[model samples]
Target: MQNHTIYIRTLKRAEHTVFCVEDGQKTYYDPQFKRMLPYASGQQVKRSLLDSFCDAGNIKISPTTFYWDFNKKKELKEGEAFGTCDPTYPDQLIGGWMKASKGGGSRTLKRRSPLSVSAMKPLHPLLAGVNKDSASFDRSGHSHNKIIVRGEDGKELNEDEINTILEGKDRSLTRKWIPASNKATGLFIQDIAIDLRRLFSIRLDDFEPEISQEVEEKLRESGWVEGENVFGRCLIAPVKLREKLIPILAYAIINWKITSNQARTFSLMETLAVSIGGNANKIAGAIRAKLSEENSEQAIPVVEEQVKGIDTFVTPTAAGYVATTTESIEAMDDAEEKLIEILSSYAYEALPEFAL
Candidate 1:
């Protein structure tokens, strides 16, 4: 296996070894020191840590924890570290190189046979910045970039200060790519026209007002419509529950403690994220916290059941939703798979073969 020593510094402290060596693409991150150094990658990490490992059918996407540890007041020395492929993915690849002093890694993974080096041009003004499309501080969901700002005891500065470091003077935080946050914010926020047209779109046999009077009456009673109609047929909107409902529900799901079950954690963070906007989550979380504190029995069991019902791979269910405009968000995940397939097959197929 090829060995490379990357200099890992503590910014204000002395340097030390994070690991000896192993397999896979691994980096040593001392959350305390706020530094990340290349520890190892590929098969080097995998074979060293994992026994009886295999990557059959190419099912696993090995994005594992390049693990390390730190005491509240002590430094880390040569330590053991490892990562697994995505846990959801079954079957593992024998990653990293096979030969000790030669080239080999991921025999199962076809080395990127780059037909020709090419630059992927941006669809917009080609502005470069950090991307930030996450709900939390890069804790989970998609692995985004994070700047580990070490405090006296390893506490990071508040998000606003960290964001300021990332954004500099750009007041347009929404449009800015925050590299420190490791988010994909620079992706052009396309013309609102796209979402607007989608919003106003009409599909076949979806909702017809004239054919439905009773429905309108129900909506009226639900406090959804406050507008006047030309025919005085003020049979207007439903409670607009879907917009703010699920997020608020998800907020309850997140902070709603299930002390009864002793389940401090659950999958609501990802499964519910699809429908819950940040603002709604924030509001809902506050409300849920209040409600949860008041009633012990009702709050605990309800949260446990809600969490148990979630499917991170599928769209989450919420209680109060009556109308929705989007397609199966499954479209998003499918498109990702399609993109990867296209890149691996069609994009690379025409490339000139590489050296042996």
Candidate 2:
């Protein structure tokens, strides 16, 4: 098993101590810090001050933070900083930071690569802004040059900004490569074409009669017609007709074009809405609030008017029939069914397949 070390910072210390969790307990050991105070178990500390003890992963200043030599390491002083030397990379290596042309700016850039020492040519014209590509003379006489960089918006950049871009920490402009999985990419072309043909069948049902006739005529004119099966019909359709069908199918799915079940569900929801003062949200909330009470008999008349025919019972009094409480098993079951239809419609409408 691999052991992970946790680094923690103290309020007064400049350096952090390392610790690890073992057997559900955390422990630390550091000679310097231990000289003042020693480590303890969780039971020894109070719960109120536990947050301070568990605080870790904070960055701090120290000479050991950077590499001072090939093998030796040292921390930077309070006022000190570290950076790459004059010859930042290998002499033969191409592409790195270089100074800009005269009068362009005092700062360096990482735009263009250095030229070979043998194939000598004058870069004066380029420096004069002929093609926006030029080279700067290095004091070390090395054949390496810096690449000029621009900001994310493609605007001109300064040295500091260009260096940040070269560091490649920001990946906003980078395209992530997704590897093809066996289950998806391994499908045969013929199989995929068949599935797409079935999908096209589902899509084509939404087209208007006139539009479908027009598409059929166009397909026949282009030497294409409906095949024996959906997949065959899909294969038979011309590219132009296929293109025409896409938007129509997309529109139908997006707007949820009047299916029988959807129409019935909408009617039921509308009926409920009208019965309970024409606001579903307010009515649902009111129903829930009223049902939560110990004796909700009084709230029955208002709710029953909405749910009676759809999900509850209608009681007939001496004068006329009236809707009463919806607390009964039959009424509850009916409400549940209606509510399911309403919720399913909402959920289906919110799906990406129905999105415009």
Candidate 3:
């Protein structure tokens, strides 16, 4: 039988420890509680310890399955390391042709799942000339838009509550793209959730790998310089590299979008549709489709027209790849969808996964 393990996380320091038993017992002695406690799989256990542990919050425990490898060895400073038998990593024979030659690198095994597309937050390029405030203006570039998030009780939220809602308990779930209108003193704030989904639609799969690699090398070389301050070890880069690299970076993003596997997740596909559309009217249609109760039909066209004004300031062509326009994104034809799916598979190849 496979082994199951439990992890106890201290509330105070948020430190975690692992525990396993020889028998398949459901209970264990908790050092914090100094007593035995019942536990179940997938449930969180929280309890207070003795006075010595007062500095921390109640101890929390979660049960999880453990994978291990007995045959392979790993290098560790203090002791020998071991591999994991997690399903995320599946071992397999090398290709049949390579097996005949006994190629050293022929046999391979899956190591982990790819990272979530959202995990590439740092890599997502900032849109050109589209500052936070630009999201608020009508198509004419007038500041007339905002996003309102109401509480469960339908009451307006205070700044703190708004922050809490936007930056939820799980920070990863929080929205990454924030528009300027959200900072204003009105009901409208940036709709980050929608923004994140829209990001999936920008088609970057066709971006030339060689060009991207060259751009990265050039940016790293030119963007960094040694400087002197309190110490001689300071390095400098712009707070926003958008101004310097926006032309190339934005072009890359406009061409990248979610792939087929990603589209399998219906919500992701819809978000890509809206983001690619880049038109408020189209996005509102997506919103209406996703959330039938809400109607964004009126507000969307205004925002769409507003963004069109920026066409003069931010022309997307850079490198040889042309920028994806709202109309192009909105097309959602069979060919486009197929291309997005294929590209998505390529993108997923670049991420790592873990078993939970």
True-structure RMSD for candidate 1: 28.9
Clashes (N, CA, C under 3 Å) per candidate:
33, 12, 24
Model 2, span 279-312: residue lDDT tens: 3333333322122165433222133344322223
Question: How far is 140's C-alpha from truth in model 3 (Å)?
Answer: 60
Tell me the tens digit of each residue's lDDT in model 1 across 229-321: 222222222324323222322222122211111121111212211211112223223112112366432221111112221211122232211
lDDT of 1 at 325: 29
Sort by TM-score, best first.
Answer: 1, 3, 2
Q: Indicate whether candidate 2 or candidate 3 has the larger lDDT.
A: 2
Error of 2 at 235 (Å): 4.3
After superposing candidate 3, which stretches have Cα over 4 Å from the reference? 1-223, 228-234, 237-247, 262-302, 307-356
Overall lDDT per candidate, in order of appearance: 0.25, 0.24, 0.23
What's the TM for model 2?
0.14
Judge candidate 2 at residue 151 and give its lDDT.
64
Q: TM-score for each prediction?
A: 0.18, 0.14, 0.18
lDDT of 3: 0.23
Tens-digit per-residue lDDT, 102-167, candidate 3: 243322222121111121110001110111222222333335535456788998777677677767
